[model samples]
Target: MISFSPTEEQQMIVSMAKQFASGEMRKIYRQCDENGAIPEGVIDTAWKMGLTSSSIPEEYGGPGGEHSAITGSLIAEELAWGDLSMAMHILCPALFAYPILEMGTESQRKKYLPLFSDEKYKAATSGLIEPRFGFDPYSLSTTARLDGNEYVLNGEKCYVPLAAEADLLLVYAAEDGTSHAFIVERDTKGLEIGEREKNMGIRALTTYELSLKNCHVPKENLLGDPRGYDFNRIMNCSRVALSAMAVGVAKAAMEYSRDYAKERVAFGEPIGSRQTVAFMLAEMAIEIDATRLMTWEAAWKLDRKEEATKEASLVKTYADDMVLMVTDRGVQILGGHGYVREHPVELWLRNGRGFATFDGMAIV
Candidate 1:
């Protein structure tokens, strides 16, 4: 009993974003990859478009509506079609905003939500995953202890996106042998950022190691339960973004493969005329349709107050893998061109890899 039709307002927002992303975001996407710096201007346009600030509260001077997933998913797919790396960079503040919106105190929300609205201030990196811990949020080598109303944290968090440039950090640590999330601002005395890890794709967003040496944080910065505070809203907003990203990437790859198969002559006729090539595109079509539906279903469930954790994981798992399949076939259809940087299938392949293991892919 759910509907995915866009309201007039939502449709207008999507159209406007599509226009802006096509015109402005596309131009900078390749430049960012070439220069190895995800510029602020690309994301500034997204913020002006209200893409990242949609998670903040409307009362806090943000769009902040509860039903942002549809619009967000729409934009994510489109942006990924333009450039996956730049789309991810534009969403940096968004990833941090989820934890705050779900777990922040009024003061914390007031303090950080405005940062997203500013279009200039980038937020912090999330220190959730560890080299040893992986996605198992409960198991941990990191330790945080309360001493005289100040929390002393000691840990090393790795693969943290945007760690080099993050202004604040949300570190997950164990206190009294129980896991807790700590809010550590940038420039803290004991916190040190490591070199950026060179990812296979999505280089526009940086990942690095964070060494927290006796990092002391105020008691008030604690977000939710050390062990119990999971932003377990099943319509998990982060994965929602990822699902849309996959759909966008897959859509583009599918189009490329289909077009290439049609024009590339093989055995006197177009390869697309061949049963094998046409079937490949056909399979891609089916998977893309399914992926889009799953994403829409999860987003739709999220826009309502419904149980969507299962649906979200399903979408994440299916779309995460589907994008890879579509893109790989896209490369196959293109033969040699797919392997080269001239085509974006390689980047799509790289982008799809990160998402494959996220959102409980191992468990699923």
Candidate 2:
């Protein structure tokens, strides 16, 4: 039986996240988005919440609280409700730590997992989403060829979040017709990072393009050892996280438009009282709720160690469309004000447009 109810701990986590989002993140999100930079203090406060460390095993220098995918989805929605770019910046470490915890060898876990537990925010990111048209994660353009004790990587990757500041990167590539991830240190030779990308949305979160020209790493850096790892599962987790973020952005647009419609006068009455405006708001709410439920179901399956590839894809596709529609409608409902900078609906709509291509920008 599926239960939608949050446990006591999950409720507490949600409350805490909500408080932070409403009080801190929401206040500064606009400024950060405009400046194209997130404040270090924001990242520090979020890091102190232990969103990443609590999941690591105590033996591996963590809080021993264990990972909960469903709880994580809830928290992600709340944080993203505050701000998308800041949420990604704050949780960027998970893009590195979770994969290691899930698929790394015992030695690899011992060597790298402890780095995420420090008191300050440490950027550890994942390298996926290459720079090319018609990209597929399963058949990465980045190739890792074995040369005795080291694997030589050759390809270019783009949209890597926090690349400039990350202490380490988990770069995914194709090896012998199979997908695998390698742990690459920040200072690897022959790895040239491009200038920060100026994108249409999520601008506050810095992304970079990387050229790995014969960048060699030790054979031991291959995640999950000789048997390889479950790349699909990791992809599924990413899909769930992205879907949750879509829900957050959509919910924000819907609520803001709804409130504006209620207050703004039209023909000597509130616009929300009209049939067209009321119906649009209702549809937006329905879609947001539906998308969130799909995300929760996918997360729940992941928590149970069940395969959620199809479900994840389902939610991601639905959310990608749903967010675009909801945000566009939000702009439409607001008429002229929606397109203006003073309101955030236009910003939300711009950000929503990129959801179709936002792979590896975040993880759960």
Query: Who wins the TM-score comparison?
Result: 2
Best by lDDT: 2
**Alpha-carbon lDDT, every model:** 0.73, 0.90
| Clash count, candidate 2 | 0
For all predicted structures, in order, the TM-scores are 0.88, 0.98
lDDT tens digits, residue span 1-364, model 2: 6578989998998899889998999998888889999989989999999877888898977888858778888888988888989888888899998888888899989998888877888898989998899999989999999999999999999999999898799999999878899999989997888999999889899999988999999999998875547888899999999999999989989999999999999999999999999999999999999999999999999998899999999999999999999999989998999989799988899888889999964367
Candidate 1: residue 82 lDDT (0-100): 78
Q: Put down candidate 1 lDDT per residue, 94-175, tens digits, no spaces.
A: 6666677766777777887777766465756577666663446556688988888899999888777777788877787877
Q: Mark the regions of model 2 whose C-alpha exceeds 4 Å error after superposition.
A: 226-228
Clashes of each: 2, 0
lDDT of 1: 0.73
* lDDT of predicted model 2: 0.90
